[model samples]
Target: MADTPNGATPQQPAQVKMQVLAQYIRDLSFENIVAQKGTGGDVKPDVQVQVGLDAKKRTAENQYEVLSKYNITSKNKETGDVLFAMEVEYGGVFLIEGVPEQQLHPFLMIECPRMLFPFVRRIVSDMTRDGGFPALNLDTVDFMTIYRNEIERRQRESSAAQPTNA
Candidate 1:
């Protein structure tokens, strides 16, 4: 290790810094398909959920916008009837600095979305509760896993889309 003029070991500066400039609800929807009083109130519904992620460079220097979208549908497996549904698109403007290009994608996809998830989850839960149902809590998502899976899927699609001849 190299020592500075003050006889102290030099420390590395921050490699990356992320700031959430603004966050807002880009879109939201909620529907209650079944009446709570119609059934016997013993209906255990199975919920299907889908989640998506995206990031784009804004017209600003060292800044990017990240969006996380989710869809939830509740259905009664036995009766085959729709109970409720919800969809949300949440986004945040992030200012990132000092990160290398190779690391920027992960930072934007994983870190930025991780920061915005709590708010989105809250919105979903509140919306469901307000829509005449119990509050729905979203499970903690593994951003790293999702990011890796998406990368692999895109690579496979691109490779298959290319032409090959014997």
Candidate 2:
């Protein structure tokens, strides 16, 4: 390796280009078959939601797969009946390269997710409210925490299954 004037290897600048080639809700489902009977005359409704994030390598060089999925179930507690069930999957392909290893996780978790979230959020809110129920608003997620937890979980599982000698 060539050394700089200071006798240390020169660090390469990161080359990162983040662009949203396309943004849309990939899949959406809303089930309100029982809304009429459950709400007991179009009463107020409550919704509970869960969100998850996942990433994978795409076929193209330096391309990535990022997905944000939400599962929401709305109910009328007083009647102990279901109001609506919705599931949505939002995903995008990101092109990135030359980014430092330390910054890669943040780029995917924070920056990429931020780009895709608004579209997803709108779908959830619009669909629920339009379906004759209160809007379903989701809280923002901390992608870094989710990414780190996933890594740690995988490591723990692998370590547990491996032989001690190996």
Candidate 3:
């Protein structure tokens, strides 16, 4: 807002802004640990995908780097043979401005990762398909639940590590 008629800043009206400054794949690896059996016939493999989130402050002001890590394992449940395994750490640099300090952590953990997930998911699907397996379609992630779980886990750990009165 243009300075008040009398030249006062007016607190900037509490603008809340968040933006993705840049995004990239920090690490990506696909491993076929064991040979995929079956001679060009219909195969049903059990696929397991694990997703994790991590974030750290960047050197620039109001910038942060958040990594969405994924570990996927595909196997034949009947034979317990590993068909394929993939690990990717996709990262995004976010510019967070005008948000309260209390809200910043959640913004980075939940919102930032949520924004970057689709691209990472697409890459994973493409990688799996390129590796001679059926494309692995991923479902939407529930980041809020993950965030809450992490908070609870950390709280429990903090309490467990503290010394009790003798």
Candidate 4:
């Protein structure tokens, strides 16, 4: 393993340190259909949003790529019609080094997502509020729980699909 520029030896054996290299809004799209209609002068708008997260290794190097995607929809309550739809994908490059093999999964699935989520949340909030809607601040996500659930689900599916040698 290469020594960190600080020259301090890793405290743990092959310790992994995740460094945020760069964070940016990769893509954003918003559409306001109701605003174009020029109607519903008194009706309040209802908004719903969904978010997703994904991570990938950039290369054999210590770099990682994290993606946070959001889908938001706004509707005019009175008309029961779509008002606006927005989608945004925020991404960042992270440097993970000296990580032990056993700890790599947790480091990538939990810690990395935790580190990247705040930036993604801010973008969604800002975009919604600035786009003439209320701020859509998201609640904290339990990535560990999500990861475990995903693993369990996959395992169950795989086991169910396999044939037992009777």
Candidate 5:
């Protein structure tokens, strides 16, 4: 390792610390359309999952709340009929320290949700299985890609909103 002047070691930035204070389901809904209708049988299901992430600072110092919302729908591919629909909003309370101010937003959006995803996945699986359907094991979500896409979308919208000289 290269040393600084007088052979002193280079300083290292503080290591970031994060802790999950609490995590729980904020809301959940499961509608079994198949049971109600009893229409589709042995039909291939097309499942669509939509995800949304949000974070807010808590009243307590160094605490923040992150929410992961999922809307899932399963439809018979051939019939275009819904088999099931599910919505879940899971939240986590985090105590974060040593993150730079500029990096905090991305940190909250990416890292906190990464920590909470497994639990959310499990809950979804359990809910679907208990609803008399095949357990839905959700694929891992790419938080960084989602964050980047959202930022790009917002930038495009902002640019489009600005008035240009005719």
Candidate 6:
């Protein structure tokens, strides 16, 4: 450790602490379109998944809430008919400390959701299995990549919204 000119040692960063206070499913919906419409023989399905993330500061000190939303759709590959559609919004209340102010947003958006992903995956798998389809195990999400893409998207939107001085 290097000492400053005043002979004081550099201060070490505070240890980061994170705890999950609570987790819940905010909303969920599943529709079996194939059952309603009755698909013909040899139905091959194609699945698509979309995910969204949001975070908010709670009123309590050092508390935050994060939400992960998933939209899943399955269609028959040959006929282009909808087989199933599902949406799930899961939330987690977290107690977080020691992270710097400049890093809180990223931490909340990325780390918090990463922590809550397992529960979300389980819920999705259960819901699918209970809804009459084979269990759907979601692939692991890359929160860092998602965060970078979101930042780039916001920058592009902000720049496009700006007025040209010319």
Most lDDT-accurate candidate: 5
Kindly report which residue pairs in candidate 3 clash with one another. none
- Give the lDDT of residue 28 in candidate 1: 89
What are the clash counts of all predictions, listed in order? 0, 0, 0, 1, 0, 0
Error of 4 at 135 (Å): 1.9
- The Cα local distance difference test for each model comes to 0.90, 0.78, 0.87, 0.79, 0.96, 0.93
Model 2, span 44-105: residue lDDT tens: 45678777777777788778878888898877767657778899999988887877778876
Q: In model 5, where do residues sit more than 4 Å from their true spots? A: 1-3, 6-10
| Superposed Cα deviation of residue 14, candidate 1 (Å) | 4.8
Evaluated at residue 53, the lDDT of candidate 6 is 96
Indicate the TM-score of model 3.
0.85
| Rank order (by lDDT, best first) | 5, 6, 1, 3, 4, 2
Summarize candidate 1's per-residue lDDT along 1-166 as a digit string, tens digits: 8889999988786677889999999998887887643665577888888889999999999889999999899988888688998889999999999888888898899999999999988998899889998898989989999999999999999999999997
**In lDDT terms, how accurate is model 3?**
0.87
lDDT of 4: 0.79
Badly placed stretches (over 4 Å) of model 1 are 1-14, 36-41
lDDT score at residue 160, model 5, on the 0-100 scale: 100
| lDDT, model 5, position 95 | 98
For model 4, the superposed segments whose C-alpha errors exceed 4 Å read 1-12, 37-47, 75-80, 164-166
Each candidate's root-mean-square deviation in Å? 3.3, 4.0, 3.6, 6.4, 1.9, 1.6
Give a tens-digit lDDT track for model 6, residues 3-119: 999999989999999999999999999998877878779888888988899999999999999999999998889988988899999999999999999999999989999999999
Tell me which residue pairs clash in candidate 4: 15-98
**Estimated TM-score for each candidate:** 0.88, 0.76, 0.85, 0.74, 0.93, 0.93
